[model samples]
Target: MLEVGQSTWRHLTLAQRARLLGRLHATVSASAEEWADIAATSKELEPGHPLRGEEWLGGPYAVLTALEAYRTSVRALAQGESPLARVRTDAAPGGRLCARVFPLTAIDGLLLSGYSGEVWFEPGVTEAEARRNAGLGQLTPTTPAGVGVVLGAGNVSAIPVLDVLYELMASNRVVLLKVNPTQDALLPVFERALAPLIEPGFVRIVRGAGDVGAYLTTHRSISHVHITGATPTFDAIVWGPGANGERRRRANRPLLKKPITAELGGVSPIIIVPGEWSTADLRFHAEHVVTMRLQNSGHNCIAGQIVLLSADWPQREAFLDALRVAYEAAPRRSAWYPRSDEKLQGAASDYPDASWCADGTRALIEIGAGDDATALETTEYFAPILGVVSLPGTGQEFLDAAVAHANEKLTGTLGANLLIDPAAEAALGDGFERAIADLHYGAIAINSWTAFGFLIPTLTWGGFPGSTLQNVVSGMGVVHNALLLDRVERSLTRGPFRPLPRSVSALAGPGRFSVLPKPSWFVTSRTGATVSEGFTRFRMDGNWARLMGTLVQAFRA
Candidate 1:
């Protein structure tokens, strides 16, 4: 790692930087082939059979999504219209966080509210005094381009490349990206896929461990630092470590302090309101919980950490049983990461009541408790363990109790979810609105998996105030959708109630069995392709003739 004294900023020439920037732009804009190769490589790194985790990361669906986003972005730029482009749900592009505004908004009678804080994209809208201290413009070199270093996350394959794209496209910065040790094997694939950028010096992949990361983070020549990982890692770089790290924090207080943005993890919670539901609803909700738990073996920060169920409501126990059955049936996942078993065991020790599915090879955990919102309920356990907590009372009472429970006990303020039915929402309209307002987290997703908001290019994902230049839980600020330049405390979201019953955490029953089948629907199938293509065509060409074309594609898939 290069110390402050050893770092050099003026080591590179102006002409070299310009050439590098040009190459990066051209390479990313070239063709869809590079993206396809990267996606395929990502599939190979799934730690297991391609069917389990590979399909989602770099599968056809993901490729299609990225390609569509790229097409839309270029088209919008060409038209000179800042129209929002629709990024298909399956394949999520990376650079959206650097855009002027989130392109995709709620359609289909569903509306998602952008954060209400004063918009900061334009000049002067920011508080003048605070703006002066932020040193925002200092990070943006007027010389057209400069060196950017990306500290990529190991768990996710696409993050490093995506971070590079965001910096290059959004900030007009050339980049030297460092792959985390965990992702070193995939380094060659990235280099090959991003050859155009690499050849031109616009982008280069340097592989190493923590030492390499520290070097890039503090390199004087590196103008910006974008990381997708632990908040502690980000903090250690910018502000040092521990409470005594105040010296570094103070030093960074008034200066540009290097433009650093991060997307950190959090203990995401799901609030299930009291509702009348059929057996299918129960099964579907159970499966939804299973999906969130089993996805990536629950390594995601947005993984459903806590389930706020209605304690007094009879459906709570039933839902638990359904979830248990679904989880037990889940295919055994390889113990991919270090300390995964230890972490799960630690959680089991803390919440002994929690259930575990260990058949010698793999472990799956579930928490079964009633109306207990303690530290165990709020903490983010990085293993496949789900805490089952409940709140007593009717729908309205449960809503109130649940919200209160989340705000008080949730470890990270990064995000939260509220699952409610249409009738309950209508009945408790004002109350529901008030509850949403009271939520202290950054992103609040309604009637859908919190991960959806993370996937959308239109949404900003992060945490609230307690996370500082030091300790960050929900991460320092938003990194996914770079719409706002200011600090965002929260993101409020709402979606269709039963769009996919099997994916809803509030339901308990046979619907739970359908979650696995849904993946085949999402990947390696024409269904997602047809529907996504139809939506894109309808939005672009506005052709009714293609509507049937879309449905037929889905049906055949």
Candidate 2:
């Protein structure tokens, strides 16, 4: 398989690559229903369950977006235009160049109003340098870099497929994708959806446990490796186990010599800037916070694990109360991922004083200050548990402390979220922007969940650019950067503190500000599957009627 892909990948023309991606997009769109069903069944979700929306967005919808982006790039290359020509660039703090990638079209702005995002280039990358590197591999389409082995993630259905696309589109390499055992049931669906690459021998999907993965990682045919998993898993793969692993890590000597890129799990934090918010604001953000944590049943690598609140903020108690209420009201999800129960039990045992909102299937734990060394603080629980900690100070002081804690004390550098009221943000002035510039996270989201950085195909998704194998915190290298820039430093995504009524804010209700409708992403919504499907179709076709139907279904949800 590797030999076939290696030979075939370099022979394809730019136009041919665009056509192939278009075909794959069509295949995935056609198989959207089956793909969602496969994911739902694997995770024990009922038919038409709201969580199925997750599978759709993460699977077919995500692939479709990536394909469109790649096709756009290749088509531009076939012409005499640079793919970066259409991008809007500006200077960011610390002498970084920021490019606005999403909302490329007016319709995108209409559909996702009150939301915009940008990718930040590495510091000292002048506008000229960024434009030069933006079209990295497309200039030499026939140059092949050999075969890559993608160790698929089990938690999200889309991860394996996305990793394969990145290896093919970004690196111009063929892929041998090893599907995680937990999601092996979706092999048929993947085979059907990604038939273009498989038929041409550019990609191969296999199933395996640790032994199979180890063999492939050490295999001679594989030139590169990418994995979406836990930090410990990456450690065990790159270094031997137990004492040897510790020794190798200490001595900066790795057992594996191949180039590896990974997107590992993190103890992501959401810093809540001290502010005076209305009742509606508190309620809306409570649900928003809950959604960030509970999405994917808290199995997501970018899930918000810690809520950093201000000890001096007068509204702290009210916000915590609202969070507890929202957490309890949200629907419980089955513990689907491996060792979920054990992880949750360990957290509970380590912090017996932590507040629990568990009802077997779903749980939320709130921990206090002195428990900093406990598992809840240092470990990625990978379960439906959120830890809340309050720190001293107000205004910029609190923001600085939170950012320092996230950078110095957190387990990973993958992603982080900042939730600040517009008023508070304005008052902080330059201090707010400085805090964003200082954050060590690869993806920094302002007033939105960091997961959006992962979802947006144009945004660079990986750890902060400078991680060594000896201390690979979030795993190095990036994926899903449609512009194809090789010197990407981080991705910064910003959204409104409270999205406009016709936008995302409609999803949260029970307040006067809510005017639009319920959002399909809500796990409590029964018609989420129908709504999400309609939205996916709309995204593919851009039909007004389909969009209307999707909105109607959202209202019903």
Tens-digit lDDT string for candidate 1 (460-502): 5566656655555666546544331344345444544543333
Q: Please give the range of 10 consecutive residues that has the lowest summed lDDT in model 1.
A: 89-98
- In model 2, the Cα lDDT at residue 330 comes to 79
Which parts of model 2 have CA positions greater than 4 angstroms off? Answer: 358-360, 500-519, 524-527, 555-557
- Clash pairs, candidate 2, are none
Residue 537 alpha-carbon offset, candidate 1, angstroms:
16
TM-score of each: 0.71, 0.95
TM-score: which candidate is best? 2
Writing each residue's lDDT as its tens digit, candidate 2 over 199-292 gives 9899998998999999999999999989999888898888877899989989888888899999987899989998988787788788888988
